[model samples]
Target chain A: MLARLRWTEFGRDPGAAIARARLISTLGPLIALLLASIFFSIRTDRFLTTENLSLITQQVAVVGVLAIGQTLIILTAGVDLSCGAVMAFGTIVMTKLAVTHGVNPFLAIALGIGVCLGFGVLNGLLVTVLRLPPFIVTLGTLNIAFALTHITSNEETIANLPDPVVFFGNTFRFAGTTITYGSVLAVALTLITWFVLTKTVGGRHVYATGNNPDAARLAGVRTRRVLLAVYATAGLLYGIAALVLVGRTGVGDPQAGQSANLDSITAVVVGGTSLFGGRGSVLGTLVGTLIVGIFRNGLQLLGVAAIYQFLITGVLVILAVAVDQLSRRRQA
Target chain B: MSAVAARVPVLEARGLVKHYGVVTALDGADFDLYPGEILALIGDNGAGKSTLIKALSGAIVPDRGEIFLNGTPVHFRNPLEARRNGIETVYQDLALAPALDIAENLFLGRELRRRDIIGIVLRVTDRPRMLREARAHIADLKINVGSMKQSVETLSGGQRQGVAVARAAAFASRVVIMDEPTAALGVRESGMVLDLIREVRARGTPVVLISHNMPQVFEIADRLHVMRLGRRVATITPASHSMTEAVALMTGAASSQGPTKG
Candidate 1:
């Protein structure tokens, strides 16, 4: 009798229905990732090889790191269009300072990261103090950072980076496959971010601020501070992404990462993090990065044209957003 | 109840004034909430009840006012300060994060940390403990919310109100001020909220209820502090006045000489 009552309760409970919806959202990307992997392995003989898998991880390292920052900003219902430009600028700062200006590599790295942090703070202050929309603020900074990168590098790629600068790009054999330190760093950062978002008070505040800023403020949350912290933290991650980029290419290419801003956003969206904010996980972002990596790599092995990758990714992004909107409408 | 005037008011305000350009929201409004009583604050549309409540709850800084808690003058620069001083408020919108779960919403700003080093050094929240305490609080109020882990957006309107009230009830050490908590609820849900208010008063914590519902106010409030033209017009109990008289005082249809002392 008790079991029957419990079953009826579960069937009728709105909370149960909502919980099921949440589960679907959280698991959707993982299932897609696995299915895509299986499909690729069947289509292309080289798709499952460790060499190609390692290469995909290596290729996604820089964008994956940038996605971490993008995920943080987007989780707060904000976007950073300047993340890629800021990262490109940071690489120039680190590589030029170390190779041309002959500053200590570590200090140059710190200075590079510091510059990104400043941009984050600048974006944050403009959003909070000036009360500007994040999209407009970040859009303005994108051009500024892009111009700064060109001026700093003088439209030149700085090469012959110091060993420490390229350390993350160095390869190490693991499980009979070559893996880059940059890939390891990207995964590590994702794990740490996942822990922070799930286990910390600041994480909760971020979600709350994104969900409803007025409600958060009335509940005694310093929503401005929370937003500032999120942007600044994202800036710090961008700086780290700059390091990974420099290490991967062994040069500071001023022209690199031009499309990375949208790419990182694509990964976040595809991974199941809502563009509207207040509901997402960084772990989902990791899965999303892999999904993009797999699709591009798989298509390449299938002898598909490069431009089709862009078309497919664009379609995936729209589908993810539509799903998010549908789920939100259901809840409403 | 007649002898309640001898005790110092738990929360008191005098000559509070607030202006938004040409519009004056609060013009020298005075308020008093005694210990362990549901004080219903009633007024017409533009009578400045919201502005007065904002000042008392620290949502806004009044242009001129003196607010006292237990006879001690207090200035709250923000809602956080008011909350720190053991005053909790449920705004008209409920002020709850819809995406957060029940336990998370219950302890939004003031989350509990584990006693161990992981929580201390890493600043991790004690989720298990918060969930347990949240369940206990909800159960104490006799609200039948199925799971504490369900996000507030998924809950029914009444359940969401229950979470807000439960949060205020759990943390409010001195006073709980609610602004039209039952305005959006159905009759049954409103009855549940009224019972919750009475239960809070029975627990010896005072409540300042702002509502336009005359019958609910008459049924629950120990005293009615009527407002007209941004000032306290009278303080009448259900025993001394009818709902018709209360409405008259609220809408300026009847004249009350001054704020009547018990």
Candidate 2:
């Protein structure tokens, strides 16, 4: 009798339906993680070590930050193909300001943030004013940002980053497990994003605008302002992530993080945020990031070559999208 | 009638004309909207009821007309202007964002921002206050909402209409116009909405309801305006005419007779 009532309640609520869908999507990654961990644990005693867990956290930090931005854009029924290039641009700007201009490192970080915001504004204006599809707009910006990164940096790595900035990444600890500042930042950001998405008015507006723009307009949401704000915020987060990436690598390389945009989007989608928008969570994206982190880590442990890793990632993206399409059809 | 008892109509349109290219959607339409009255605008589909409402609500510019507000000529350049001038329209779509919850939907356009007279900071939302007010306001209208935090997409057809009415009433200064608020609702839900319309009218806010349901029109409306072929056929008291007479006037069968007397 209790089971029957629960089923009826679930049938009546779309929120419940969405919750159920999220749960189902998570099963794939959770099972994969478990099977891989067990296989590695039996084959290699080092797999379950605290040191390996710490390594995974540090490695996942870059992709995890970018995925948060992708999650926001996807929730708004848009995509930002320029994210990876934007990170490269941010690094280039940060390096130039710090190395060439001899600016304070903290001030250089601020300058890098400003540059990303400007790029975001350009994208927002071009998309909103010109009425271009976000995909096309971001695609154009991607090439532009990529070329500009090279032009600005002269295709060279800016080495010997200021000690203060590197310190931000190098700080380490072990509290039941090894953790770094980057991982801490990533986790903190994920939590903050979860709160904002679930608890704030502006966040609700994002969902509304993404779900149905016409309805949101009539509701007087100021959708244009909201869209511009989302893009700007994404750029700012990308800038911060760029800072972390540069510090983590201990060098500002223009070509580094070239695959960030694709990897972030893959994590977001795999975590169950629909590309069509109106439904998702930051927690899901975290899980998605972990899946990627573990998959890469486990594959490397299995002696798979780095080139094969790219092919596998490509196949997984296709599989994830196909699953999403199928689930949408089922729901409809 | 005593002068105090004889209130000047809040809104009046005289010889209102509207044209869409070669189409004459409304021609010389006349309407009088009195304060504290539930006025029903009824007609067959495409009988220019919408065109006339659009003109009154300032959604479309009238080709030729004189709209008088409180006995003074007024021209609204846009819907926002009309709203400022005490005219609010709830379209058939309700215009509520589905992903947002009830509180956000209610305060979407004209949100109350915090005002600090001194150096003290303020949280504008005042969630507790807004929630309490929203809850009390909907209860005053006597509509049942499952929860204030539930998204609009979770609302039923009738409940959504109630939300739309509540939103219009909460913000509108003088007049609230509902375009087919009951057309999509169930029988009981339609009855609930009609009851809310009566409550709105009792509060001395004039309501201009556009509905096709004759029973609903007769139930809530104090005065009925019939439109036929882009012209006002007649305006009559509901108590003075049966539903049959109203429909005949609406369909143009009794256009020459004007409003049929009891």
lDDT of 2 by residue, B97-206 (tens): 66567776777655443344311232234455566777877777776675677666666666777788888887778899999988887786677678788888776788
TM-score of chain B of 1: 0.96
Q: Candidate 1: where is the Cα deviation over 4 Å? A: A1-13, B1-3, B258-262
Candidate 1 local lDDT, A52-161, one digit each (tens): 99999999999999999999999989988999999999999999999999999999999999999999999999999999999999999999999999998899999989
DockQ of candidate 1 (2 decimals):
0.51
Give the interface-residue alpha carbon RMSD of model 1.
4.4
CAPRI docking class of candidate 2: acceptable
Instruction: Report the error of model 2 at residue A117, Å.
Output: 1.0
Go through the candidates in order and give each one's DockQ: 0.51, 0.24
Q: List the RMSD of every prediction in angstroms.
A: 2.4, 5.1
TM-score, cand. 2: 0.82
